[model samples]
Target: MSLTKDGPTPPPATARRGFLDVRDLVVHFFTDDGVVNAVDGLSFSVEPGRTLGIVGESGSGKSVTSLSIMGLNRGRGTKISGEIWLEGQELISASTEEIRALRGSKMAMIFQDPLSAMHPFFSIGAQISEAYRVHNDVSKKAARVRTIELLDRVGIPSPNTRVDDYPHQFSGGMRQRAMIAMALSCDPRLLIADEPTTALDVTVQAQILDLLRDLQKEFNSAIVLITHDLGVIAEATDEVLVMYAGRGVEYGPVKELFAAPEHPYTWGLLQSMTRLDRKDQDRLRPVLGSPPSLIHVPSGCPFHPRCPYDAQAAPASREIRPNLIETTPGHQVACHLEPAERQRIFREEVSPGL
Candidate 1:
């Protein structure tokens, strides 16, 4: 199936604008060194049958946001706030037992590394069956049949026999597919995939993305796809949320953001991507400098230290943090640059190089 932004007509909507809504979410880890603000005042929403891609460099709090949404960050030393509304149910205030019951039924997660996520000792069928049995009351024989069907649906060959194989027996791609199957076992309404294509070859990555698109279409599930790969975002997501230093710096429809990104950090990210369409033989340009430490994040705009255009905003960019402001109907950006100036820069300077 084509992974285009356009897809089948969605099911009728309710009064709510988002099937999954996250508002001003904050997640901090109180380490011995200091409090690490992993996710700070981040907000976004996803409607059913639409995929929202969260992209950022490492340490930008992409995974932390997903984990927080899944209620997997509950423990000592971690502090979380803000609202996570799934189908109008508030997840942050929900009890641990409530969240546990909701997982794999109302929502599910596909972890970055399936090899580590899955238990090595358990057979694939046993694991999937157990997950199914948790949210569903079914006989072992019935659960096993459902497990085999899921394995088959995910394109594992000879599901009847392969279901008995251990996680160690599967290839990286196969393992990832199995993880997807497990996440979809209960036909959840929301799915979070964290770096699902990591460590896979290009062919396998494409296949996985295609499979995700097909499955999303089939299930009409709201998806949060967290990854650093811009190509994947462009290919599979209806919207994109660009994170920087634990906050969203830019967000909009995927195509529009790619066409005219408003933030300097976003320009840097696009420049860093290896473009197959460009005619020049120039070397790939990377976004200069490493990400900032979350424990002691830079004052004001967290990205100002490395922003090439920070001089445009001068001390203001250094003295004050910018909140996301609408630059267009749906596009929002957190930058001090004037909207007109941003467009001029992208058109005259950044676009040619990109």
Candidate 2:
């Protein structure tokens, strides 16, 4: 019993450091039409053992942000600027080989679609072992053994046999689990899950979320969960960042953000979700107007075009850009509307409806 007394202790709740920091992240693609701003001046951070959810509609730069962090945007006629510091290491400045080494060992991503992300031609064991071998100087037999352990850790039944099966041999949920196992194989400190629950059945979705939660506690990994599902964001994240066009419109604690969202774009996202909490609520009413084209994004606030509060907003929303300003401690919103007015609208109109 005395031997257990000296176990490592997690920092006090107030004494956490930013384990992953991304500042002014800008990712642009050169296209026939023009340069498309996939991510525009985005900045956020996640601490070890915490989850930060990046939520938005399709093309809101959620996946692009994750890809940029992983350096998957390299050599694609893409221009990426900004500093992605993972555990104080400047990733943007790191050499290609340096980043490649860190890809699985320090940072890993669970992609949205494992079917497409995994190699169908190879067996799961080979793929997993190859990933392990890339960062470890282990024999193939040792790698295969480690791969089976990972499969077992991620809850695969009869993992020894499943390890030899191809990607197509695994079901949708199994594939998703395998993806998680691969991401965890190297015990990465940072895990980026881009729509980890996409295209799964409702039950399987819940299972995946639970799996991530359990694994996160075990590994104490900093996670950036990218998803359009607000429900998943609410249940999974410690903080939330709402992206519009390509920029962050709202960022704050999940509870406070969900209860008192300041940005109009965030309001639309919340109002549109089909909440089982309110059975009598009518059918879902999605945000009006499609997301603006990134190449032709509106001047000033990118959300101003579809913004219901545009008429009520100040000149900034119409003619000048609004910077991300902190209205409350750790709560930031980039909107031209005055903080008091935004609060009043959410409190009087938005909060009551949903």
Candidate 3:
């Protein structure tokens, strides 16, 4: 995906343009302590044919950013700025009515927890059909047909009988597949999945990820996947956005980022992934320290406090916040130190074997 301005409009038509284009998006919440910058100056684009992963730790603005795009954070004392274009329409300034119309039809979200997303009282069929009926002026029978099809499409077995089951009746993995079915009820152009496989076991997680990939190919919908798991990003996304302290510290192709991570934060993330060397296998080396509070972030680099490279014998790594500079053709990094210097420190002082 060549990200040239001339390639496509901010939000092209559903048939002609890209699925989503977000530019300089800012979401701030008013709290007693102060303003919390949940999403600060984030920019990215998602074409209909590909998936974009927003990976970071909790409070890294992954979920908040996706919510902002879906118009789900309105009227919650949240102030938003910047442009969010969906299928050529600007969602930022769109009326509540307009956004409501677009919610499950043109755009839909599959939340992390299926138990919470589904209504306890409503049967799976009822909830799924309701999603379709809310968007389209179809009869209940037609919506039921669509609902059953979606359930089957999402790999749910016995869709005919299971559709009548309640949320609690289904297992964890089944409930998640049901949620994906509901989100895809209207054949949405964009699917925003917020940690879709968070609480599931490893086997279930792999299944869900595979299901998502297959669905994307079938529906050709643009996906915005928000997750803390780098492995998920590696498997499912075409592009990766490494966010830190509400800002996009790095963004590029998934393979390139994983192969040669430019940002120190990204490097930290890669290093933290679990490694297997032999039959015994070793435990994962987790990233050190928690993220800073959004209310009172650090002055220079928000990640400077926890970054190991900062403590090394390098002056440029400690003093100033590095701008996200284009180090390579498509690789971008926000480090004051040169690429050669950072790579040297990362290979020598940080992860010598990597």
Candidate 4:
């Protein structure tokens, strides 16, 4: 990669893209043991007023991709490549100062844990106002007003009074709401929510999702929501990206993918989720085997070890890595199984249970 003091050299100009477009992104951690390929050649895009859900097991590179986009994957042992474009600008090639300027005002993140993310000493309002002041040329009083407005907008009850409460003072749901308020303090055009509903009760999760939808409608912002909940993906996202072992295995429109998923990995994920509609289901069908080690990922198809249909592809599945190919207009999957065989299995075996 070409580099100067500023940062990595920008790629040549390309055609106009979505509000946020990430292409062939790769993230690796040069640990003492070996290089951990946290993310490998993952690509996705989110347009204004739309949400993209990334679902996968732990250590599946979901969070790494988000951090890479936010420019938080910088350190001694970390390396990131590929393009992260917001609007017409390339981010991976941008300078530290440039990334810093865009972080809050142009793009912001609602982190998974609010308690650890927020300062214990500072009041909720103080933190939000401080973030607002950093980007906007406003007095403290004006910033405070904006904070309250954001808090109220995000459904924080009695925002004017509760704004003074510290992070610990708020419940888990409230803390998440506060985090959302803080993320939107600047009306950022792109929002990255890393497990925004994690740890909250079911009702609270639904409320948070609703709040996000409302906010998206109001601001027309592009959102990247990282979560393991397939239900959340079905309910909130326009598109779903199923990841495994640091790579995207299936990606497509949420409704169609969920209705008739193609990849065996995607089928396993769907089967694993608890279904309230299926009363006959005595137990959840968990995906067999464990995720592979990123440092020494399985050869060929990373998920072949656990894939029930691996025998169908046989030597190819074990010998060569499958490239992500478009099975339909906008849906893609990475697997060795023939499209006809995949559709047959899904139609005969998977759809009945689901």
Would you list the C-alpha lDDT of every candidate in the order shown? 0.89, 0.87, 0.83, 0.88
Best by lDDT: 1
- How do all models score by TM-score? 0.95, 0.93, 0.91, 0.95
For candidate 3, lDDT tens digit of each residue in 103-189?
Answer: 998999999999988999999999999998998899999999998999999898989999999999998899999999999998999
Residue by residue across 208-256, what tens digits does model 1's lDDT show? Answer: 9999999999999999999999999999999999999898999899999
Model 1 residue runs over 4 Å out of place are 1-17
Give the 10-residue window scoring lowest on summed lDDT in candidate 3: 2-11
| Alpha-carbon lDDT of model 3 | 0.83
What's the C-alpha lDDT at position 143 in model 2?
A: 95
- The best-first sequence of candidates by lDDT reads 1, 4, 2, 3
Winner on TM-score between 2 and 3 is 2
How many pairs of residues collide in model 2?
Answer: 0
Q: Give per-residue CA lDDT, model 4, range 1-354, as digits (tens).
A: 011011133334554566798877889999999999999888788899989999999999999999999999877899998888898888999998999999998999998888888999999999999999999999999999999999999888999999999999999899999999999999999999999888788999999999999999999999999999998999999998899988888888898799879999889888889877876735678889999999999898999999999999989999888877788778888889999889999999988877
